[model samples]
Target: MFMSRLRRRMGRLAAGVLALAALEGTCTALAQQMPAMPVTVANPVSRKITESIEFTGRFQAWPQVNITSRVTGYLDKSSFVEGSLVKEGDVLFSIDPRPFQAAVDQAAAQVKITQTRIDLTKANLARAEALKKTGNVTDATYQANLQAYQEAAASIDSASAALATAKLDLNYATITAPISGRITRQLVSRGNLVVANSTSPLVSIVAVDPIYFYFDLDEASYLAYQRASKRKMDAGDAEPALKAEIGLSDEKALSHQGTLDYLAPQVDAQTGTVTARAKVANADGFLTSGLFGRIRITIGEPYEALVVPDVAVGQSSQGRYVIVVGADKIANIRPVELGPKFGSFRVIKSGLKPEDQVLINGQMRARPGGEVVPQPTKLDVPETLVPDPN
Candidate 1:
């Protein structure tokens, strides 16, 4: 009975070991035949990318003018509608002209009186000369008549100068726009007494077309731009005009194109930055002065760069990375150094090549070192995706 029990136990142990071995073999075969994770893949795009820098700026009118009273008088009427556009030399306000006109009349009367005196003095001098030649008047008396004639002529000249001054004052009664621009609200209303050349202005005007955009460049950016400019000059190439783009605060993309026109010669001591300006066309009068804007300027020449869809980038403790397919159809994790965004694509500054195939979709299923079934596809880079040229 002891021998029979021992045989049964040995048999059972042997059967269990065989079963375990068979199950292990089946599992290995099944894993080997398993299908790879399906994923969409594309090669990195190669393009000439121009590096750029963005800054906050404000739009300013090309010409700003303050309309002030030239002569003291009561404001009679305003020729322009408040907040309306005005052309150069357009009349804006009218001061009370009666006072200026009365002054002019007084000056004219003085001129007339001086002319009559001159005529009388000339007649007397002529008579004195005739009398003197005929020995009727003394030599001293003739000399006195000549001196009186000269004094009358000098008085006429003074009266004429006074008349001119009066006429100028009359012209000053009409305040006109010095430039073509949009006028601000009337600062001094009609019927208000305005002082001549006062600290307060009657109105303000700002040029609308061809607006100016002003921005500041930090010390580092200014130095970089200077170095780039020097390099271009040293290469015997004509320095290309720097181009810029502008967008209003509410805008998504930079829709306005402009050219960099001015750069301050010295950095601001208080701000540690250099002021720069660009000219932008605003024929439609869409842009207004004092409006905030976002500006981008191309800082360097175009060079070849690698780009990929922004969706392919992943963030982790190791930083940004993308899934790439290897030659053996295995998924590999690649860390990338990212740069500025180009539309829906991200610029890969490093750790990527133009020829490498990257997984665009199904990245979650494609584990590192795992096999993948890549669906080859082409990347569509639209013309709008390209940034504005420098």
Candidate 2:
């Protein structure tokens, strides 16, 4: 009797537990089908956004000059130090001037001799003219004396010009910098003989105050920008005007500054691209010549732009689209015309409006035209952006 009672009590307790568990599962299932899945979105409006054309170019000095020696002689001394800034007319090197100095002296002596001869010839011509009047000399003799004096005067002038030429040649032996700039090291050392008008250069000078950055644009990009501009102008946007800025690859931007200084008149037939140039200041000497530089050119004005996260945009054979949330909590797959991409955002040129909210999270599993419960989530994190390495 006791064993039967214990077994019957245990069986009753187990049956009650099973019934409660089944009721709880049924209630949980009903709750899950009640609340809707959530998503996030953002607002769009008019912003001063920039569109940039990317190109890989290099930095070059504005003025580069190769210093060459104009006189033939052994270099006696280098006046200016290597890699030093020099002014125009600053003596860069001194050549052995003993030979040139002797040559100048010889030219001067020749001029003096020619002048003495001219004086003597003039005296003889005067005496001959007097004798001709007195009938003591023939006309031919007087004429010959006159010619001799004129020839002597001509010889003096020629000698003076020769002296000046010799002095100039002597000055050339001391090679001075032609431009005010930073000059490279002496190509030939002291006691090394450099010839005049030779192939070798004695040094080089480069101006570094304001540097130039050059880049290229292919024909396709050029034409595409033109076509897009025409369409924009037709659609009531202003005429096609482009601007630009500069940035280091490792930095956001050196500054929000730069200008479109140059554009090629004709396209390069070989590469089918147009060359462009930008001038940037380097006052602190931070920028070095021949360093790699980036040139960014923005082509057009900022519009009343609609933007969405790049991840939210899905592409297909039809076109790019996004699962957009419209009025009455309805979800719709809307096709959009996309403009240039700026960072992580895509500019929507058409289709979606400013009020349209785009679904970012839980978008892949969401069904179109279904009820969307927008759950605004904060995505600000400590490591959202990873900066590029230097």
Candidate 3:
């Protein structure tokens, strides 16, 4: 019985020793991980910010006109050399005038013949009137002669008008440009017959000094702007009108500046977008018609915001989150409210404090309440920046 009691006492002593050793190992491991990690962080400071929207579109001239011939004949001459500057009233083409000239001459000869007939009738009426006075001619004969003379005079007037119309037709054979512009390639060459109402246009003229750009914005953008403006009014904040800038993606800012000319009244039902146009001056003709371009629009100013590097942020079934090392060196995951992404940084709307030593490095493999040894590193700088206010 005494030997049995001795064995029991030894067993209890051995169990106690093993438990104490485990406690010591855990304490030592935790002590090795505690240190202030060397990290570069940015403050959630106040400054002016802008919400920008970008889109692609094509450039086109404001006014483009097509030049066509009104009257048709053989194109005898192309007054405008193909691809040359022409002014208003500049003679552009000439048709063969022989045919129209012959027409004018024939009408003139007819008018002369009518004049001779009228002169003869007037003399005959005078002779008839003298005979009537002597009673040698009947009153009926005298009345007939006077009527014939009046009729002949009417014929001469009608013939003279016909001759004038023929001359006008001859003038039309020579064509002139209606407007001052750069002429396009001649559609008809010399010796090509042109009908008075031909289906084809002789050439085209486009005014290229001022150009327009067409772009589109979605409904979400429109709604966002409206909400932003309403918020300012409710809070009695200074509401500023929005502005925009434009550039070719490959090129720098356009030298000439202009304004947003129009916004469509209703959304485009087919695409669920609102069409907008910007007018850009091109007096130098640098911006050609039908060229591609992009517009960077500044919609609103930035509000106060807190942000963190995108690399440090993590996502799960619970949405975006980050591991925050508490003051006691305990790691805890906190849910964060995130706003728009600005380059490599994410705007933290809420749920994170500025003083938090956010474990940016090794976040992909870390967990909450687990032992964390921080290895500090450089923060990423955003390449594209929002508009900064002075």
Lowest lDDT 10-mer window, candidate 1?
A: 381-390
Model 3, poorest ten-residue lDDT window? Answer: 39-48
Model 3 over residues 95-214: C-alpha lDDT tens digits? 888888998999999999988989998999999989988999999999999998999999988998989888987988888876655678988788988888567877876665567888
Candidate 2 residue-wise lDDT, 1-390, digit = tens: 999999999999999999999999999787557555677865543444545566767777878898877888899999988887788889988889999999899999999999999999999999998898899999999999999999999999899998998899899988888877778887889998888988878889988667777788789767755665677768886644445556666666645255556668989998899887777776655666778766666555445666666777888899999888776777789998887665566667888876777787788556677777876543332222222212
Estimate TM-scores for all models. Answer: 0.78, 0.76, 0.58
lDDT of 1 by residue, 213-329 (tens): 999999987887777777777878685457788999988888899987788999999999999998999987889999999888887777777889999999999899999998899
Worst 10 residues of 2 by lDDT: 381-390
Against the reference, the lDDT scores of all candidates come to 0.88, 0.75, 0.72
Following a full C-alpha superposition, what root-mean-square deviation does model 2 have from the true structure?
A: 9.5
Could you tell me which residue pairs clash in candidate 3? Answer: 49-302
Task: In model 2, state the lDDT of residue 42.
Answer: 57
Q: Which stretches of candidate 1 lie over 4 Å from their true place?
A: 1-38, 126-137, 228-241, 268-271, 313-337, 349-353, 362-372, 384-390
Question: CA lDDT of 76 in candidate 3?
Answer: 87
Error of 2 at 318 (Å): 3.3
Q: Which stretches of candidate 2 lie over 4 Å from their true place?
A: 1-34, 224-243, 248-271, 360-365, 375-390
